[model samples]
Target chain A: MNIDAVVDFNHWRDQARLLLQQGIHPTAVNWSGQQQTQLAFDSPPATAESSRAYAAGQVPKNFIKLARAAACYRDESRWALLYSLLWRLTHGESHLLHLVTDPEVKRLRHMAQAVRRDAHKMHAFVRFKKQQINDREWYVSWFEPSHLIVPDTADFFVKRFNTMNWSILTPDACAHWDQNRLQITPGVDQPNALIQGQMSDDMDKYWLQYYRHIFNPARLKTQAMQSEMPKKYWDNLPEAALINDLANGSGQRTQTMLDQAPNDPDRLRLKSKKLRQQQDAIRSKQYPSNSAPDQWMN
Target chain B: MQLMDKLAVLADAAKYDASCASSGTTRRDSAGGQGIGSAGGTGICHSYTPDGRCVSLLKVLFTNFCIYECSYCVNRASSQVRKARFSVAEVVKLTLDFYRRNYIEGLFLSSGIIQDEDHTMEQLTLVAKELRLKHGFKGYIHLKTIPDASPELLKEAGRYADRLSINIELPTQQSLKMLAPEKSIQGITTTMSRLQAGIDEAKSQRKNRQTISNRRSQATFNFAPAGQSSQMIIGADDSTDGTILQTSDRLYSQYRMRRVYYSAFSPIPDASSALPIQAPPLVREHRLYQADWLLRFYGFSTQEIVPTVGPEAGMLDLHIDPKLAWAIRHRDWFPINVNRAPLELLLRIPGIGARTAHKITRVRRHRRLRLADLQAMRVPLPKCRPFIETLDHTPAASLLEQDNLRRHFIPPVQQELDLFQAPPTPLVTAP
Candidate 1:
């Protein structure tokens, strides 16, 4: 039997429940996410007269959670994998999920892990560009995710940035948050003109400076950097442009630091004391330590 | 100085510190506040620098103007580096801007001694105070505590910050005195003890309030909810791996430190004639970290990792990881059956980790584990082939009895020299 394409976990869950209630075997049902077929099935239609053999609560809570995440995986085999695990769990093998060596259960876990990792990468790599729209602030970001996780990871952005207005655009879907509510709409191929024009604003420049200086040339480990922040995501990252130049010049920089002569201790101490006195004079005029209020003290 | 230039200089000054973790804090978000931030149990690495270190937080010193003459520090009074200081308001703005853009987890604001210990500590706390109380920001905040700062300032720092740290700088008091003349081991430990007590008292009070009220309220006062961590310079003085691990073991057990970062002494802009001319091998730092994890999580002692009597005494084997090294030395404990071993024994295997051991125990309950089962779990077969025994496969007796087993795990000679060239023995050995 064939059903319509499943859009999300809820859509897949509803149809899977009907298939399970009808007592249809997982292999007998074809789980397709593309074109819908006509009402033609080797098995009969799901009937209300059939007793509810497996209700929602009867299924393990862990199975439901894992299945929900696994359903978001981009593979076409995910639907069949989830149903196979669900079928085995209800059918005598209630301890199937515990056997991590089982192929069907292993695939399910791998899919769920991939989905979770994709969501985490989205959280880490999404770069928001600030824009002024109609005299109000809006943060716009463009991301290319590997799975259908735009809606699943929306709550994290909302709870964190609830006071600001922001939108995360992706190839498959987009998430937007105004101060009041969150809205998920269809995907966009490109960012709007305002966001594109402000890509190289003062924020990006400051971030570049921070990235360049924070690196220690004495300990260059490009392999470690590439393992975490892979080259696939480098095009969107502004700081990644400086990585090759910095890495290529690290050897000379370290040598320069090593070959330099040690400064005279007495001369350095005198210079530091003079600089401190000048800084203190300027700071006291601006901050007046005694006159400043201690309102921050509890 | 311009803000851009100050950022470059201050960030460069702060690069020597190795702690960038922003995890293990009280989970919070800006749902109903006038801010835009959130921090959860897990920290996010927004970027990685070329040095292979994570940029989890915007790590910077408030000012690189010090009064102490530490021989190893880049911002020491006798060093000739550019100086820059950020106003409290400037730090607040940078944190908010970076956090809003999702460029960082939060601020890691440390500073050199500007006026005195108390004055510097107060300035650091003020940044956290404005972020929490004024803006209602819930992001992570880590402040480097001054050892001689007043208790009141330390208490205030705990109330506003998520994590607090004070660098031990060296392993022993004699080395600390020789290098950093102004600091002492006793003063640093006293501050750490006070901070630990505050963290403990606030935690207990929170638990009591939750029990009495029968609810988890948002109003409970938190004192450095993420706990305290510290860093030690590895190659700065004549300290052995055994001594360093012993110090860390005490810190973890006594002071309850969350982490102890081991930073290899890197080359600074201005050379210090008193210190070594060359930096320690980076793999030494990596091996120390690996051995540190064994102490905290694997239930291993400092002596077991670096024994007193051996050819390679008091130093980690740079060619192999610490775990496999331990396994190679104690070969009598090998060939353990995977299907019957407990979690502790399973963890002792060279290739199995904490998570993999737990999975093995759980999976064995349903059925007998076979050689194929380990492969399905993504265990590295070549690493564990001789150490573990399954239902279908048993390692040959001669394999465990071979004297050249260590050579099997070591990489090729050229790659070893390229990646982990051992420094001169006199420079690394403790005199």
Candidate 2:
């Protein structure tokens, strides 16, 4: 097996191109992300001949973009898949990329789709908490992404949240951004670098409140919810804790709502104001003005 | 009330409005800006509620206090639903906080009219203004504009909000008048026209700008780049499916509305006796969305969709999709050759979506298509095979002429989703 000992997509592509130039079949190559180069004899063949050989084989611009994205996927199989497609494009099946119905192409498309979903999910579900690190406020989040997409997706976050200093830690990789530039590094097994608590102040409490109320009890489709934001993601979400309580108590609430007089004039907004004020007063008494981390209202 | 308590009350009040889209805005980011947000392009749903609805935007009412006695609304003056209001600063802080947490896309700041329409509109606008200016937040903001709100405030709102919507509430003017006496059909339409004008003006300014140093003149304001949408409450009034689609078609054509959200009348606590006691079936709401899509994409006019005459008049065929029903009625147009059929003809086939039709057009250039080629594309073969002709596919000679053809496709009442079942294999093998 012609194993290329590198994690980078560019390196893999370079090796694959050389292999294609040398007329190496896909079945003879075993592409890997493992960082162990074989001896000089077994290393990737001379690249000088590949440039001339690759020029004869025309790869579609669409496939280049698609393969670039698919390459960043943590799956080792993507390299071989891309190389095989590359070999086929040059040798025989010039129009093979357009045949999306082909099983191999379909599998490649699904992998690319999964990577896209991973990047988009990273954009959506990374819950950043503010912390005073070395007296400078920084946002840190712990994300467990399904694929190796941090390098490709970090630009989106940098553009969106450039003003704030933040770090996103995942199992496969980590990304940190200051005001100036982004620094990506190899990831650790656990998120020991991130603070789990100490910054989830009153705003988080309000978030939970919003989460509890925003849900409609009458139309419960737990499967639909799970399908979109799967179980693995639920753990990191601050609002995830309320899903069960909200779900379990929804039926009882609906029954009570149904049992009550629908037409009854229950102007509780003003009436409940006094009771809420009393609770607020009690809260103030329990916690004096001098509080660490300050109130989240600011 | 405490901020959390107020948020709970306001969000609960706002849950009935079902428009949760946070997309189709002018793309911008906080890059080189003094803030922490970005918008435009596709909207991301950070969370999904158990009801299968996306929580893309932080949808909440600014206040639940209303002067109007709209019987359908829980927050109407006549209703006893608990009311709470957010101070502008509170809303801004909450929005920024939630956005930072990545729990929301942006804010959908709507309000119940407190003193007047202008006053409510101003309050909603201020929250968006502060989020943009004070925080430099480039995130999406959707404002709900009231009908009677002054054009000045609307212009101001359009400047700050990515999208603005005023719920039409009901399909017909007569039903609207009966249910919501405070709202006028003319006022709503006028607001829509103003919004349309603003959107068009901005678009043209951007398009036809005399580029001075690569930027447009300051006179051209970026006014609601995502444009305006409206919502219609189904089952609250006696309006039929025909009346609804007609209104929708008008809204789409006239106002250039981005979307007309169809909210199934949800049951609220302390419900008004004036309204229908029971909410419409969720299936009906689903059917309407499917039909709406057929109108927008499938080139089906309202008249053709809900037959102008018949026993099944003014109603969509609930058993099958509206597209399938239309295709069945117009069977003479069937057996269009898939290898050479144009997009419009291919679209008329029930199973072929826009994507498949486009794919078919592209794929046929390489080689002639067969039943297996279509199947590999996951075209719903059961619904499509009779109508389409591929190189190796032929329907039974009498299948189109048979009276039981439609019945054969329809599932027994037990299986609601059986009609959508994918074929197993080799129903029609390729030559």
Candidate 3:
């Protein structure tokens, strides 16, 4: 018995439900993507009586949530694993998912965690470039996520950037927002030519300047930086180009700062006094603290 | 100066502050507003600099022109660094631009005393006000509160900003007086106390409104919904880790601070003869953070982590983490049964974290846990082996009593000779 290609969690859940209703064991059904020998036996048709007996609500809510996340994982074995867990939960092992030490449960948990982490990284690393399209502004970005998470993360981008026209292009799928609705299309191999050409904008220059100066040469932790912002994502990041130069020259910069001589204390005292006197004159105006509007009072 | 140059100078001046968190704010998004931003998820680190500091927010000072000469500050009035100030409109534009590009979480605007504390505080608050009220921006905003600013200004700043912070600058009042002559501990704490009162009042009012409405409406008043946090500069004066942790502990309990950042004093370009020329080791700051976590989350007291009457008094162990150090000192508490121990005892184990400890307790309900089970859960066995007892494995009676137990956990010294030799060839390389 072979199932059709699993497109997403919904597809997988529908197929798994049919398999469960037909009383087919998880091992007996071969998901289409897996490279396994075909089973010789044909699966019996699912019946209404079995379906009524194993209604969707009978499974714990936690299993559904975990299954949804685990199904997003890129591994081919996920469908079988999820089905096994679901089958056990309905077959008198209702407490199966709660056992963290169980090997199958642990495997599912790890896969779900990986999917979540991939989505989080997508949120953090996506860089949008501004472009002019037909006298209107559009923000475009090119990202390569590790899993089928483009659809899952579309709502986040839409909610945050609803006022702007933007598109996130990825190899698996692409998400676009047009102020009124979100549209997802098939994946692209390359970003639009306009986005590629306009990657380096005036804002990127200022961003690079901010990044260079904000770094503290006195405390260099290259390993820590690499762990969080790995080298794989550096090619797309404008600020990452300066990382090696800044890290390499940090030692010399710190030494130069140390080599500078201290200013004269007597002159410093006089200068400080002069500044204080100047500030006192300005303070004489006594600006009212409540001068600003209190719109938040309501 | 150009906006680019000012950004370089002001950002350099502001890098000394260690707090870049943008989480724990009220959940909001620009769904129906005229802006394009959101907040209130786990804080996102858009980038990390080589110093390992997260660039979660566009952290910059509004101005570097100062009227007070703090000995440790780069922007002190007496320092020879270039001075620059951003107009309120300029800051608003910069914040919006950066946020739209997804380059930052939001703005963390601090300033030096341009004319006086009140003027500087007002300028800082106006940036947040412009962002929230004019643009309807829902992104995170953190404002640095001037200690001597009036209460009304503080209240206004809290209303617009998600988080507010005032640097304690030093551990004790004496040190603050000696170094930052114009700033006082009383002024800082008094402002913190006022912020705390506002936060509490708004919280209770929100509770009452929720009860009255019997619904979780988004219209409740928010006053620094992320609450107040503060920073203390370590090694600025001669204050020890003991004194520093004690100050943080006090701030946590007394003022209800959400966090207390410990920044190691780094070298400034214009040397201040009154302060040290060299910066402390970065590891010292890391150890202090670990010890701080034990205080807040691990149910450990300040005295237990750093005792008062010892040769190593007032100092954290520079080599090993504070948790392992405490575990070695209190050997009698070891051999805690993994399956039967309470959450608190499980948390005390060297290798088990809060999440892992909770997982252990939950797993043990169905079946007794063994050493292999812990390994399967990804707990570091070597670190907690002698301290924890499992169903299948237990440490010998003499293992916990060994005098050399501390050395076992300390990472072995790196051998420079190995680097000169050729690396060992892999027996089987992956295809």
Note the clash tally of each candidate.
0, 0, 0
The count of residue-pair clashes in candidate 2 stands at 0
Highest-TM-score candidate: 1
Candidate 3 yields a Cα-based lDDT of 0.83
Give the per-residue lDDT digits (tens) of candidate 1, residues B39-95.
Answer: 975889999999999999999999998877678899987787899999999999999
Cα-based TM-score, every candidate? 0.93, 0.88, 0.92
Q: Candidate 2, clashing residue pairs?
A: none
lDDT of 3 by residue, B260-309 (tens): 99999988788677787657767788999999999999999999898565
- Model 1, span A3-80: residue lDDT tens: 667788888888888788787777767787455665445555544344347787778898998899998899887887
Looking at model 3, residue A120 earns an lDDT score of 83
TM-score of chain B of each: 0.95, 0.93, 0.94
Chain A, model 2: TM: 0.79
